[model samples]
Target: MLKIKNLYVSINKNLIIKGLNLKIKKGEIHIIMGPNGSGKSTLSYIIAGKPKYKIEDGEILFNNKIINNLKPDKISKLGIFLSFQNPVEIDGLSMYNFIKSFIKKKNNNNILKNIYKKCEKLNINKKYLSRYFNLGFSGGEKKKNEILQMLILKPKLTILDEIDSGLDIDSLKNILNNIKQYINKKKKKRSLLIITHYTNIINYIKPNFVHIIYDGKIIKSGNKKLIKKIEKYGYNKFIN
Candidate 1:
C-alpha cells in the first residue's frame, strides 16, 4: 500500500533519513527497528508528508500514486494516518469534539457507528469524552487515544511511531487488540508500519515483515524470528 525508494529527508538543513527504502503490502504489519538517531522516526514523518522534514530525494508512492510533495492533510486525505510517538495534550479541546470533527473530515460515514463500540473495547469511558485531548492523561491514556483515532479514521495505511512506549502491559494489550481487530475485520484492507525499539509490542501485534534500520538505512529484513535474535544479541553485529 505504501512504498518508499531512495528516501531521503532533512530538518534544518541536516539530513536525518538517507537512502531508506521499503514496501508495505496491503493488510500487512511491518516493524521498523533501529538504534538511536538512525532516522526511523524521520522516515515515518517523510512518508506521512510532514513538511518540517524536507525531502532531498526519493519517492513515496501510496496506492501507486506518487506523494512526494503532497501536504500533510492531502496525504491524510489519500488514506494515510500517522500516530505520533509523543502525542501532545491540547487543553480545552475535548476528545469527543476532536474525534467528531475528524470523522466528518475523513467522510467515513460507515465507520461512525462503530466508534462507541471500539472505544468501549479500548476501555475509554464516556466520562473521558469531555476531557481535553491528553491533558494530564496518564501515559496509557494517551496511547489509548491514539488507538481510538485509528479506529475512528480507519486509514488505509497507519504508521504507528512508538505507540508502545510508556504503555503498561494491560494497556498495551488493549491497544493491540483494537489494532488487530481494526486491521482484520476491514472491508477495505488497512496496512501498518510500526516503528518500535522493543519486541514486547510484537507479541500483541504480529509483524508480517521486520526490518532492522540502522545508519539511516535498512540492513536486515526477515520474519518475526529475527526479532528474537535482536532481543538476545542486540543490534551490534547488525549495525557493524
Candidate 2:
C-alpha cells in the first residue's frame, strides 16, 4: 500500500532520513523499531506530508502513485490515516465537531451511533464528546482519542507513530485489540505501519515484518524473531 524509494529528507538542511527504503503491502502489518534520534518519527511525518520537512531526493508512492508532494489533506482524503504520537489539543473545538469535520460524507444518526459504540469500547466517557478535543485529557486519554479517530475514519493504510508510548498495560491492550479488530474487519488488506520502541506491542499484534532502523536507514529487516533479539541484546547489537 505504501512504498518509499531511497528517501532522503531534511529539516532546515539537517538530514533526518537518508536512503530509507520501505515497502508495506496491502493487508500486512509492519513495525519499525529504533532508538531515539534515529529518524523513526521523521519518516512517519514525511509519509503523512507534514510540511516542515524537505525531501531532498527519492519518492513516496502510495498505491503506485507518486505522492511526494501531496498535501496532508489530500493524503487523508486518499484513505491514509496517521495517528499522532502527541495528539494536538484544540481548546476551542469540541471533539464531536472536530471528528465531524473529517467525515467526507453526510453525517447522520448511524454515524453518531457508530462513534458512540467505539467510544464505549475505548472506555471514553460520552460526555467528553461535547468537550474540547483533547483539552485537559490525560496522556492515556489522548492516546485513546487517537484510536477513536482511527476507528471512525477507517482509512486504507494506517500509520501509528509511537501509539504505545503513553498507554498503560490495560489501556494498551484494549486499544491494540480494537485496532486488530479494525484491521481484520475487512477482507481486503488494510495495511498498518507501526513505529514503536516497546517490545510489549508484539505481544498483542503479530507483525508480518519487523525492521530495525538506525542512523536514518533501516539496517535490518526480519520477522518477530528480530523483536526477541532486540529484547535480548538491545539495539546496539544491530548497529553495525
TM-score of candidate 1 on Cα atoms, chains taken together: 0.93
Worst 10 residues of 1 by lDDT: 104-113
lDDT of 1 by residue, 66-176 (tens): 999999989998999999998998999988778887676554554444666777899988678788989999888888898888877779999999988888888888788
- How do all models score by TM-score? 0.93, 0.97
- lDDT string, candidate 2, 160-236, tens digits: 99999878999999999999999998836698999999997889999999999998999999999999999999998
The TM-score, computed over Cα atoms with residue i paired to residue i, of candidate 2 is: 0.97
Reference-based lDDT, residue 71, model 2: 98
Q: Distance from true position, residue 31, model 2, in Å?
A: 0.6
Error of 2 at 38 (Å): 0.3
lDDT of each: 0.86, 0.92
CA lDDT, candidate 1, residue 214: 88
> Which candidate achieves the best lDDT against the true structure?
2
